[model samples]
Target: MSGPTRRPTLRDVAGRAGVSTSTASLVFSGKGPVAPATADRVRAAAAELGFSGPDPLATSLRQGRVGTVAVVVEAPLREAFRDPFALAVLDGLADELEAADRTMLLVAQPADDPVRAVAQLSSQAVDAGVFPLCGIRDNPVVEHLAGRGVPLVGSGSPDGPGMAHVRTDEEAAIGLTTQHVLGLGHTRVAHVSMNLGLRSPTRAARPDDLEAALYLDAAGRLRGFRALAGDAAPVAVAADLTVGSGEEAGRLLLDVPADRRPTAVVCQSDLLAAGVVRAAWALGLRVPQDVSVTGFDGVDLPWLDATLTTVLQPGVEKGRALGRLVRRALEGEPVADVGFPVSLRVGTTTAPPPA
Candidate 1:
């Protein structure tokens, strides 16, 4: 004859368990240690009262901490998760964020998306946001999130106002690679770069019918290559920064008349370099003996028959940097731009170019 069984409140549980509301709250929240017997009594009472727990929304509003980070990317959901560089960078960020007791909310911005997905930004629940290895120029997602006063950090350079950044020193990395190739006494050097467009005047302009458009990674490496090689640098763009792209680039370079072919090829990634080496062998050219190739990224690539002469950037370290930055921003600390240096690993991929 009761209208409907009244929903049990924390007070009902506390009253039934013969404890103060504070004790009942502590036991339920697991924020404090309680005697096993006392905890059991509270649970028993809560079960009898049909009270599961406090409402998450009410609790979040009171505490003002959402405990989630928004990881925003400039690609489709699948592509964002698939790309190796993106994966590595995110792995670093996620590992650190998890260690700090925060969760990740991955959001990918599609290229062909017409209406900016910025309408989805809501700091009403998330602690902060991250943009790893991509830009935010004309990006509504970033604008909306930051406009909502959500603290922001990026795995790469900050693309907008007040966003913290933790990035590898691309300029330094390129300079190191170029110097290494030059050190090998190879004057005819070519760059099989990643997609270009974000960082150069020649970005949107296709290098030729054969080259792919520019990307940020390619632009930074090309900048370094040109700086070191001067006016007569050899460069080509890849449709993508994959091993296949490297091999195709290698074949194309080799097909370039011998007098114009690059004796040393520097690729944007280890995979590309491996491909170039494979393609070179296919053309009956000896690595280092006929053409030297170098790659970026210290990723273990035994598939490459030759030891890649490359630089090892701390992928884990970079991830940790992003994590720390995210944590700092979440804690309301002023996060600044972080730059990690690169180390060179000289492998057998390079020798004096063919006599």
Candidate 2:
């Protein structure tokens, strides 16, 4: 064996193309002026030699910056991305990062063991970090990244000094739908909440539940709903953000005698609202006629027949906002917290309670 086959390098491509190695680098980096034909020749040679261009590690070292940003999500990748809103936010963040010539390094931190993320990130190098979604109120990663002098951005969780955020008034945002259903004369309204933290079961939420809530977004929205719906209102917490969890929460609240059932169900997310709608149908209940349903996060649900009444939060825009903040921080600009606004969208799913 001749010391294993050597991998093709930029020099190999440049030599094959009869050009300087610097010219080959310029072609890949898309910097500096080069003639069209010369660029074509280098590309052709690269193809012929199976050269994939410059090494990112070497380039980053030369630039004095890693072209990667750590995007911290609260759930497992499969579970976190299941929501369309989450996917949209990721898309927007990816778009903006691409514009800045940066890449996203996804880091999923389970709520049960948030410090695990700190450990995972200890060995990784990133120019910055982001909490792109709701997470625990007090994340250990915040302290870890802060100590490393890495700039941090978030959308309203893991709050601490020096971390810029695209903050949403969660209480006011949830109030949009809560007030909508209340305005529709649905007095016996029930609430379906996303899990307060990891391993939360699908069951009624007690007053003490809010005290122990790790997810601030869920807690804030719950408080908003309670403000309008009252302390004694029937509230169910989903085991997770999934439709299955929502459906289970729905059954717990809706699978009861008509007189005892809530006239409207205000859910914390469109996915959960859709699940509640499905559960209603399963219980032989007609939406609006029997129970009005409203949700937060006005995500598109094409499969559901009735459009949901929800808080119109533009997920992609929020993600872009988070990305822009990161870009500013990385560029040595003084970044500040940004306020993201939301609106209430009324849909056919919500109507006045039945006679």
Candidate 3:
């Protein structure tokens, strides 16, 4: 048999088209000026020889870019998708990447073994990485990727060399809602916080937990609530970012003697606030009538009967902000932290505490 069939290369196409391989490459890559007729001839030749474009790996090797970004979320994809805010952030990031002819590879960091993510990504080539959801304060994957010189962007956390962020004032953001309820004459107040630090359990927040927490956003919001609510304010921790955890937290705080119960509960997230609402209803309490509740991150919760009084942090815009930072880094532009501002929305969920 004649040797095994040879795959057609750009050289073969160029030979048939009566053009140089360089000219044929230009036609394929659209990286240089080429006469229309000549470009047509190269395509014809490529078609005749069944030659596809250049090998993507070889092209990336020559171009020094893989056109892939690692999107690291602290939770599993299933859990992340359940949160509307996470979905919007991801949607915005995807929009920016698609416009730039790039792709996103989502990586979920295991709460118990975060280093596992580093090992999984060590062999893959990426132009950059993003932590759209603020991650652990010290992340191994960030260290591994940064060591490899991949540009990094984030909403917050794992911040250092080779990483830029679309910064948010978590402390100030949470304070808006806390201050809102406090302004309404609710003295007996409680705070519901997301888990602080990696692999934290759902329970009452202790002073030590806030001090040693690795998750910066959660810790920051908790501190902000305590700052305005005072040292003796009751605080409960959610197991995760889900509504179920929020409800559990709500039950912990709301299932109490009426005289001792808080008049308002300030939550760290909208999902958590919804849970608190359900818990209140289950206990025969009317929101705003019996208690005023407020949440951070004004995500849409159509399922809930009442609109949440929340801090309006648009998730999609934040994602786009993260994308913009990533794009700048990819272009060799000097990437710097950009501020992301949030405002407060007063909805039906808050009012002067019950008479």
Residue-wise C-alpha lDDT for candidate 2, range 1-355, written one tens digit per residue: 5688788999999999999999989999887899999999999999998888788888789887999999999888998779999998999899999999899999998888888898999999999999999789999998998898999999999887899999999998999888888888888999999999768579899778889999999999999999989998999999988888888998999999888899999999999999999999999999989999998888989988999989999999999999999999999999999999999998999889999
Residue 101 in model 2: shift from native, Å? Answer: 0.8
| Model 3: lDDT of residue 94 | 93
Whose TM-score is higher: candidate 1's or candidate 2's? 2
lDDT of model 3 at residue 92? 92
- In candidate 2, which residue pairs get closer than 3 Å at backbone N, Cα or C atoms, i.e. clash? none
User: How much lDDT does candidate 2 score?
Assistant: 0.91
**Comparing 1 and 2 on lDDT, the stronger one:** 2
Give the winner by TM-score: 1 or 3: 3
What is candidate 1's lDDT per residue for 83-148, written digit by digit as tens? Answer: 565678788888999998888888766545613456555433688888776543446666777877
| Per-model tally of clashing residue pairs | 7, 0, 0
Candidate 1: which stretches are off by over 4 Å? Answer: 1-8, 112-116, 122-124, 136-138, 198-215
> What are the TM-scores, per candidate, against the unseen true structure?
0.87, 0.89, 0.96
Report the alpha-carbon TM-score of model 1 versus the true structure: 0.87
